[model samples]
Target: MARAPSSIVVFIRQNPRTRQKPNNQIRSLTFENKEGDCGNEETKPNPHREPSQNAQNEFTEIAKEVSKITRTKPRWEQTLLSDFPSFNFSDHRFLNEVMKHQNNVLLSLRFFHWLCSHRGFSPDSLSLNALFDALVEAKACIAAKDFLDYTGLKPEAASLECYIRCLCEDGLVEEALGVFDRLRGVGVCPSIATWNSALSAFLKVGRTDLVWKLYVEMMESGVFTKVDVETFGYLIQAFCDDDQVLKGYELLRQVLEDGLDPGNAAFNRLISGFCKERKYTKVSELLHTMIAKNRAPDIFTYQEVINGLCKKRKSLEGFRVFNDLKDRGYAPDRVMYTTMIHGLCKMGLLGNARKLWFEMIQKGYIPNEYTYNALIYGFCKIGNLEEARKLYKEMCDRGYGETTVSYNTMIAGLCSKGRTDEAHKLFAEMPCKGGVRDVITYNTLIRGFCKEGKIVESTNLLNELLVQGLQPSTSSFTPIIKKLCQVGDIEEAKKLWNDMQSRGLTPMVYTQEHIITGLYEQGYVEEGMEWLLEMLKHKLKPREDTFKRLVHRLLQRDQSDDSLLVLDFMLKIGYTLEKGIYASLWLLNFAKRIPDLPKHD
Candidate 1:
């Protein structure tokens, strides 16, 4: 016990916070060690001895190794809410992204909500302008309204601008005006975009008067910092489209007055407008202007000019334009050639059209479907059915498949020339020859049958259509009914009308009137009057001729009282009775040799 191990004391001093008291615990450990170390006791290692300082160093080294193995800087981190304080909506790049990708309405709304919530922006914050823009790009008007209502957001000028644009794009001009009124009530003056949108809408729906008023209003607002090309361009287009080429010229003057040169698109629109109005002199003046301005004409400009000249029956002038286009190193495409062909054909120069067709082929420019159709139609129009058929066969042989137009031309040609057998044969062979018969085809064939006094055959064809699962339209029934009435097949015509009604197809006014006329012509005056009254009951007024014919037919049968009754009914229903009606009724009453006149009720 004299010299206790110094290591134990060192360990106790190092772990001095241990619960063992240093004095008693050290003394008891020393006494036990001395007793165990008696001469007869074997020397034993001290199991309770504290670890050496080297062991603590090794533990520290392992922890450093562990940290080195597992730790590194992260690549990315979550962005905090306070990052971007101001976001622009009209930024072009951002707009492109919104348009190109964020097209869904719900996703846009959710993104807007996240933006509003995270940015802590007020409901009226300008930062939310992009969200409104996104709604427009997505065409989500209902969502936009919901967003405004849910956020208690008052309409800002930008919001109004977006709403007006969306509404105008959807052709809801009246609704757009209501939004403009709302903007004015809110004291939010519209921006250029908003004014332009309203102007465009007015012009689109042919409200030129309103467009001019808006233009004056916009000029007076003193808000336009600059007049853009698009502003004048749209105005010029509106003027030209509305058939006011002179006014369009005035607008061009205004553009020049404002120190702006009209661009090609603007000039083209003016030229096109003049061309459409057949004002070739003005078109020429504009073309010279374009040349003086060094604005090279594109294909569309040339087409317009050529087509304009052609429409005026100036094929030689059109050919001059065509040659001019060719000499300018611009290859004459199908449209240019088609214009020439159409012009030539219209001028009764089908031979030239055929010549141009051959030239087109020689130049390795294959005639398009429209070109072939035009030639065939031109031939048919001049009663050259044989040539039309020959052309049709050539078109087929050249691997140019026939369209509904091709068949229609051939069938209509044959029908016009009273070649019903051949027309019917071609019509029947249409589907088998890889051609699908559309409504026009059926209408053409039906009309052909009716024209040939084959009412029963035409009716059978109509039935065949129904059996083949094809639905005939109002147009389909109209001509057939008219022809049937023309042939005095009133009973069958009425049956067809009933069939139409049963199939949920309402006969057009013309169709019904035709049947009524047919009834009158067939000496069914009472039935005609009854049907006319039925038409009036259903709010379908008969035309002037239909009423007069029915009344005259009734009177012809000495039914003056019935005629007067129908006439009174016509007048009571706000229809003006023609003077001929009363004269006819008076003459018929005078001519009648009735022994006893029927007393009025």
Candidate 2:
């Protein structure tokens, strides 16, 4: 049965699933006479409430007459004027009733315009909301927007919120944001829900930059008196994702001070950020705060702390935290064990590393390649090459695959012990053993060969590295350059030095020292001074010992002018010359019968 006309207002407030069923009743009105009076079935007016109730009845009757004429008459506004000549079309109550009852948005819009043309006709908030709700329900958003522009009315907060939310839902977030600004310009403050809708929309589209700017505007407006946890969560995650963790933390602090908890996910993000920045104090404080607030720190939380400590070279503190988690009955995962082992090995604490290694294995955690590599690295660090090799063999036997890192670690260990031949053999066997040789692989062997004074072999590897399209780093060239300088091949060293720059590599200070010393030793004193000035131009300082040797060589050659130039340039560029070198320059100047001593001022 169709409910009374009063139920139509309740229908608009219902969920879409139920609202679709009653809409027919809102449109069902039978006109029995030319006057368009609605057919009465059962609803009776109250005698005691006659004054206000009669007005409501009259408004309902006129609304039904207008809807009927709009549907059947081609010229609806002319028909409305002729039929209801005595009706107050400018009355707000009559406008609201007609907006609520009208089914066809186009016709309703025409009637609205006709009424608007009447003098003194103004749209109140209720009538505006009714029209917006109808237009939005009919998906006549363009028309609704046109209606808004036509009236030029400042919509109330409730109507603006609904409009903004609909725009956001339609994936028109930028348009919605523009609408929000226009509404606010007219002195309308949308509620917190409205702000959150726009915020959530931008966040969904991954526009955190826009979200942050809008949030700043939201704060500056001071309109939303209360910000819920969901809104805070959005801002927190957005800030953290943008690498603005400190700003995220400030928002979190505000959330906590508001006597609300942002839950574990937010806390974890802040903890992870602090870990990346190595802010252990803040991590500790957050962990403690989480526990105090009845939000327990999960395994990932402790894992981050351990990883951070290990990276900062505080493995002992990391171990303490690891042990505390175990004592508290929290099971450390394989990642945590590997992180601890890697740290302990780096610190050369082999004993503790071995203990943890055995414990992790006994706990039924199969050690992966990283786990084996960490122990291998520890063994290598301690010069236990046999044990390191044994671990590598065991890793291969267990089907962990021959990884390049394992091969590199073992090769580096062999090379460290002057086993260059063995290291080269391992390097050669890498391709057959499914190990891809990276730049480190070539650099390692190059460094090893240079250390053994096998310059020819190192040069061959450098050429092969270039042919394979592997970009060599400064480490790749520095050792080769130094080796050439040691063997009185200053010209060859200069060629390689220029080659490094052509390949877009900047030579380190050590590379400069090698070239300078090589030139001086080869009796190219002038060229050595030029390289020294080049170093100073690039703001590079050679080792103090190298500078001393260069100066003494200048004095031995009796090049007093070049030596004085070197000292003056050094002082000008703020390099403090050693006392012995300065005194030698003074003696050289005095013996040359020069008019003035080398100026110390």
Candidate 3:
């Protein structure tokens, strides 16, 4: 047979004298399985059996044996024992090969311990990693833990690092930390990768405090000859990404103060963080620090600065930075232009904003949705309604499907100019124009109808929505309800009122109270009292004035029976009656004149 590569093992380390010779000569061990897939024969050879069949047989037998032994407790000892069943490896490579297809990690761990304790066996790093990797990939955390604490298994530091990384990838940070401390406790010297892995796991869970502590411990432990620059970069990210920029800055500055070079990414992270927090002053300072330390600032560094300027409403400053970037020969990307456009729009500098808009198109940049909205909104804000309309049509003609925002903006602009009829036209045609209208769209159009006192049109639109199987929001109905009540159309108002319940839309105070007030004002006092009872049913308290008005109206009608009921309901809801109402209640209840004491009678 040809020699295998130096990487693969032909024989494992064991006592040479204990090596067993095969009883039969090695035969061709390949076979076709049920799926016609080829695999190696299990080392157990029955001449009648195919090799592939034997590999499966070996796995099943080992699984059965492991299941049998671990079902009962292990008889563990400081040293190997002939009697301890869990320590039985089945005395073959069966356990090792069995790990390849096994996801039952605890069973694998038991076999792993047995392999480690088996005398004359020195398991290589490959075997150690294979089993542990299987455990983690199977998400057998408890099993991985068992393997970690297996007193008989002593994997080297290199093999242990791999296990730690798998734990981190699973977001099993806490478990990874336990394994890290345990490996080091066993006199295994961890490298920088090991320490960083632990830090990364803590960071994954937003545990910045633990990350800081772990970093300190890594430095003090001095196990590694050098820490990687990426270590500090990750720590900075954890802090800054959590919006703890100051903490990140403190960590970076502390390392720099200690003369530790955590590399350029450290400076870059702080610059980005400072920019994110809109701390323009600190950003500038950090940029200068980067230059002083001979760190090269990339395009990203400049972009963040410009973005910060834009975010802080310093458009002129952002343009200045943009100019600096151009001078440094870094061609500005779309984001930079968008930021500049956004900043200008915010400052009401529409003329400049439009100029940049054309400039961006000329430079072969297609403006995105936000870019269009900003320009349209700018025109609307400056009272250039016609210009806003022209641009909105241009947006649609360019195959730009109208966003809810774009449509709402147009409606809002038209409504602001009292051109609500045109606003309704645009809204009614949104679906045909490939624009989807959400609740905001309906709310905006309904608001326009209510503003123009066109309640009929608003009600029609609401009915159309219901026909289309869409539910109306509070804004959808509240304005129309208020306007109908304003016109004293109580019957129609009552129709809408009942419709609210049938649609499973609960009428709020604005709806319920407005209807009650209109009914009461129109001498629908007895019916208005019914509305209050309904309000109480929904656990919605009537306004105090509404309550008091109803009580007074009921007493005026000589319906003291209803008035007393109202008073009791009010008191139950923690409302104090007006002193006069209380006096009336006293006269109605106990302060009436008796025949013997009624001299005035």
TM-score of 3: 0.49
* Tens digits of per-residue lDDT for model 1, 188-213: 77877677778778878888777766
Worst 10 residues of 3 by lDDT: 21-30
Ranking by TM-score: 2, 1, 3
User: TM-scores for all candidates?
Assistant: 0.54, 0.58, 0.49
What are the runs in model 1 whose C-alpha is more than 4 Å off? 1-146, 155-226, 244-246, 253-260, 264-267, 270-278, 288-298, 309-317, 324-331, 346-348, 361-364, 379-403, 419-439, 459-601
Candidate 2 per-residue C-alpha lDDT over 241-311 given as tens digits, one digit per residue, 9 for 90 to 100: 78888888998998899899898878887887787788878888899999898989999888878887888
Candidate achieving higher lDDT, 2 or 3 = 2
Predictions in order: lDDT:
0.68, 0.78, 0.70
Which sequence of candidate numbers ranks them by lDDT, best first?
2, 3, 1
What total of clashing residue pairs does each candidate reach?
0, 0, 2
Model 3 residue 355 lDDT score: 88
